[model samples]
Target: MGLLFGSFLNVVIARVPAGESIVHPRSRCPRCGHQLAWYENIPVLSWLALRARCSSCGLPISWRYPLIELLTALLFLACQRRFGWTPELVAALVLVLLLVPLSFIDLEHWILPHELTWPGIAAGVVLSWPMGWGRVQDAIIGAVVGFLVFWGMEWLGEKIFKKEALGAGDKDLLALIGAFLTWKPLLAVIFLSSLQGAVVGSLLLLVRGRAGPAPDPEPGPESTPAPPVGPEPVDTGGEEKKAEDEEEEEDDWEPGPTSIPFGPWLSLAALEVMLLGPLLREVLPVPLDMLFAGAR
Candidate 1:
């Protein structure tokens, strides 16, 4: 079931950013426009069978497809073992479904679509009903508090640094997480995510010479060649100038330094708190245990 869902998630990850419908037109090869046969859509097995290439076009398929399927399967098994047969297990599974796609999408695009986060906030509150009224109340408070906390930080950062510090969607993501986990664990989530993101982002900066992707270099005047001098010049109707302008407009733009996406790190920290908070609290010192104990 997890593998199947993961397969569907691949479609969501690919299409959502482009504003394409995930269900419409069916899956087809981008290069050859060949509709995938039933056998060709069998999760990881199909990719292995086809040798990671489209049957019609022979275009090499990305390895991320099989990897996502396997990763989802493993997470599903882990949730089953941790929560057993309970409402919490169902919530955990739903979270896994949401987080996997969101994390990958953020990593690729550095943006978290509100289409996922808004519905996720609602779902988290609704899911808490099974636990109790108290849990539902906590969910509501968590959502509000989570949003306000991040909003305050963003405001302060903008005032202090005179630039945008956090992505606009990050607060929504944190609120969704808080709606599921509640306010008490939010501090821990923030702490863990910040610590991990800082460490990993620093390492990436060291290795790649940038925290995030490098910005596209602006085209210079030197790139355009001067028109040849001749007694008689053929009339090209300014096609060359138009082409150069189009190419310049199509160049990709990237964010400045220290601009890593925080969504993935937040998702990872939330998952860790859900799955391993209890164990961590048990093993850690008394002072540190209090931080992780709220989630458990």
Candidate 2:
């Protein structure tokens, strides 16, 4: 079941950002436009069977396909082990579903769509009902507080620092996390996300000289030009801001070489708190363990 859902998630990751329907067109080779048959879409086995090439056009398939399938399966197993057969298991699984795609989408596009985050926030609160009103209340507070925390940070960055520090979508994503895990562990979530992101980002900066993907360089005069289209789609960084209103504000910011996406780091921290909080608390020193005192 995890593998099957993971397969569908690949479709979500590919189509959602492009503003395309996930179900309308069958899966196709992005490189060649060859439609994939049912057999060709059979998760990890099919990838191995086809030797990681499209059967029709022989375009090399991305390893992400199998990796996501395996990752989902393993995480599902971990959730089952941690939560047993309790109602919380369902919540954990749902959180996993939302996080997996959001993480990948952010890594590739650096935008967590409101489409996913909004629905996920509602789902988190709804799922908590099975555990009673206390859980539901926590979920609600978590969502609001999560959004406010990031929004405050964003406000500070813009007003005091004179730069946009966080992606607009990040508040929504953090709210989605808060809704699922409740407000208690939010500090730990922020701490872990920031610490891990900083460490990894610094390493990436050292190794690649850039912490995140840079925009494609502008075309040169010698570059072959395409026939002029009326207007090309401008990437709005996943925010649904009005183009005319945001034009000037958008021009004020560009992703610097050291910029990195925070959504994946947030997702990773949430997962750790969800599945391994107790172990982590025990493993860390007493001083550090204080951070996870309220962890579930």
Estimate the overall C-alpha local distance difference test score of candidate 1.
0.79
TM-score of each: 0.85, 0.88
| Candidate 2 TM-score, true structure as reference | 0.88
Tens digits of per-residue lDDT, candidate 2, 5-107, equal 8998999898998889989799999988888888989989999999999888888999999999889989999999999999999999999999999999888
Candidate with maximal TM-score: 2
Model 2 has an lDDT value of 0.83
Tens digit of lDDT per residue, candidate 1, span 82-141? 899999888888888888888888877777898889999999999989989999999999
Instruction: Give lDDT per model, in order.
Output: 0.79, 0.83
lDDT of 1 at 136: 92
